[model samples]
Structure formats: C-alpha cells, structure tokens
Target: MVMVEVRQRLVVGISGASGVIYGIRALQRLSELGIETHLIMSRAAKITLAHETDLKVAAVEAMADVVYSPDDIGAAVSSGSFATMGLLVAPCSIRTLSEIATGVTSSLLPRAADVALKERRTVVLMVREAPLHAGHLKSMLAANDMGAIIAPPVPAFYTRPASVDDIVDHSVGRALDLFGLRIDIPRWRE
Candidate 1:
C-alpha cells in the first residue's frame, strides 16, 4: 500500500479592516498551493467585506476548508495542540492587533494568533491601518516581540504592478513566504 502525507493546514483570520481582499486572496492562493485553510472571520470582517468587495459572506466562507466563528473561543485553532503551519491575520485590524499584543484575546481570531505564538509557529499580521499613532506602533512592536510578524500590506512599486489585483497578489504572496511557501509572483530584483 502507498502512504501519502496529510496536506499542510493554515489558519486564516480576517478582522474588521479596510483591505479584506488580502484575506480573500490569501485563501485563494493557499488553495492553489494545495494547503488546507481554516478560517475565522469577525463580525466586523463580514460587514467590511460587504462594504469593500462584491463577495458575500457565504462566498468567502466557502473558500475555506473549515470555518470557525470568531466568538468560538473553544475552536481547534485556539489550542496550541491543534497542529497547523501557522496563523495569518490578513488585514488585521488595530483592535485585533491590540488584543493579540496585550494577550487579551476577546475572540477566536486573536486567540488563535496567541496560540500560534505560544507554539512558536509563524504568526503573520498584515496590519492594514494607516496614519498610525504611537499606540499603534507600540502594539506592533509588542506583537513582534512575541514572535508575530507585523507585515503591513505595502505595495511593491518596484514590481511595477499593473493593477490592484497584482499588487494584492504580490503582497499576499510575500506574506506567505514567511511560512516557507514560495508562490509564483513577481519578485524584486536586487
């Protein structure tokens, strides 16, 4: 008999941020890479999706292999034992970042990130806020100190992206690189 390895799993969190498209594109790319995705979306994230994208909440949910409610604190991903490659909170809102930084997770989204940090697994936060103040910078530094990568989705103009989707894909692809997933996207030449 032949044996096969289980597909790698990744936890994806979408918070209430302006760029929900980053989370959506992350799921799509992970699926293309044959990695299983477990998703947790906050209520604010659903509202933001409706306002920002043509995609419905149900459509976004369907992109994941499994979906957990943000309020479900007992979810599998909230436990460090639930093996996963890492947690990626694309377009992480300031509230979520604050929660994770302070270790006061009110929802499964930040809780999962905390678990990943405790397990020493990769936790990438595509923090999407702009005009940040000192508090935001402090929170980011705190999270980084706790082994979380604060990867704001800054566009790489050096890639000379032709469209908004290209920019998003490049950012998403680069974020996935932290997990050792090399996706096929334009790279900056040194």
Candidate 2:
C-alpha cells in the first residue's frame, strides 16, 4: 500500500551482485531528495547483504518508501501503468541482466525493467560483474539496443575519490543522471 502519493517516483531493484551499497546509497539519496521509491530486492540480494554489509535487511527495506516482493508479479511496479520515472537495477547481476536482455523476466525485478522499457521510461542497469565474456557483452549490447542504459559502476578518477564511499557516490550519481535525478556529487570540471 503506497500511501504518500509523491510526485517523483522510481523503481529500484537490487540484485545479488557485489556492490549492494550502490542500491543502498541510491535509496538513501532518493529519500533525501523526497522522491518516492519502490523497492524490489531479490532473495539472493538479501543473502549477499549479510555477506557484504553489517546492516540488516529490515534496515535496507526501511530506506524505501515502498517495498515489493520479488515474486509478486502482480505488484504495481510490474506494469507500465505504475507511473515511475524508471527502473534502476543497482549492482545488476548477470542473471538479472540476461533475463532483462532476453525479455525472459520471471520475477519482478527484471519485469519492472521490462515494463519501464516498454513504457519508454529510462532504465539504468548498474551491472556489477567483472571479466565479462561474449555472452555478457552481447547481453549488454542487446539491453542497450532495447533502450536500457548498461551503466557499469566504473569509478571516476577525475573526482579524486578519497575512499570507497566517494567512488560509489560518484558512480551512483552518474547513473542517477540518466534518470534526470541529479544528486549533487563531485563531477568532472573543465
């Protein structure tokens, strides 16, 4: 039951990739900006959260304005009528990326992205895998061809990041830029 009825809304999906913090920071920043967030976190993402961060699942869930079960295909976000700015799959796993690319979405994460794509909304996938193979590259290409931005969270050296958090913020900010939700972080200067 989403109640607030905020103006700007976004669908954020977290996969079982390495950098769950990308999604976490996105949630925090989005909340700070008063954008209503609809979160769909994979079960694998819950397990990875335990291994990656000390924060509990409930804490992460609390960051979003609304949370949806990944298995609930009937959720509002699974349809284009939900009226979100778009879907942001942070730390997008290869499996999730492949599913979205092939249009074979079985769960709500990629399903929301599919809906966004079909609705002509911005869909930004922060793919987190390293050492990509032909299949992975092809999937990225296909996703890009389908209007999804395959934005890997590559750190910006020009920002002169002092820590891991800084790198993450810069990358997340850049990704949010694709959605026209600009977070005020260090940017490249002339």
Query: Candidate 2's residue-wise lDDT over 1-190, tens digit each?
Result: 8787559999999999999999999999899888999999999999999999999999999999999999999999988777989999998999999999999879999899899999999999999999999999999999999999999999989889999999999999998999887888997773
- Ten contiguous residues minimizing lDDT sum, candidate 1: 181-190
Q: Name the regions of candidate 1 deviating beyond 4 angstroms.
A: 1-4
Q: Per-residue lDDT of 34-90 in model 1, one digit per residue for the tens?
A: 999999999999999999999999999999999999989999998988899999999
RMSD of each: 2.0, 2.9
Prediction-by-prediction clash tally: 0, 0
Clashing pairs in 1: none
Candidate 1 lDDT:
0.95
| Every model's TM-score | 0.96, 0.96
- Number of the top TM-score candidate: 1
Cα shift from native, residue 174, model 2 (Å): 0.4
Looking at candidate 1, what is the lDDT of residue 173?
Answer: 95
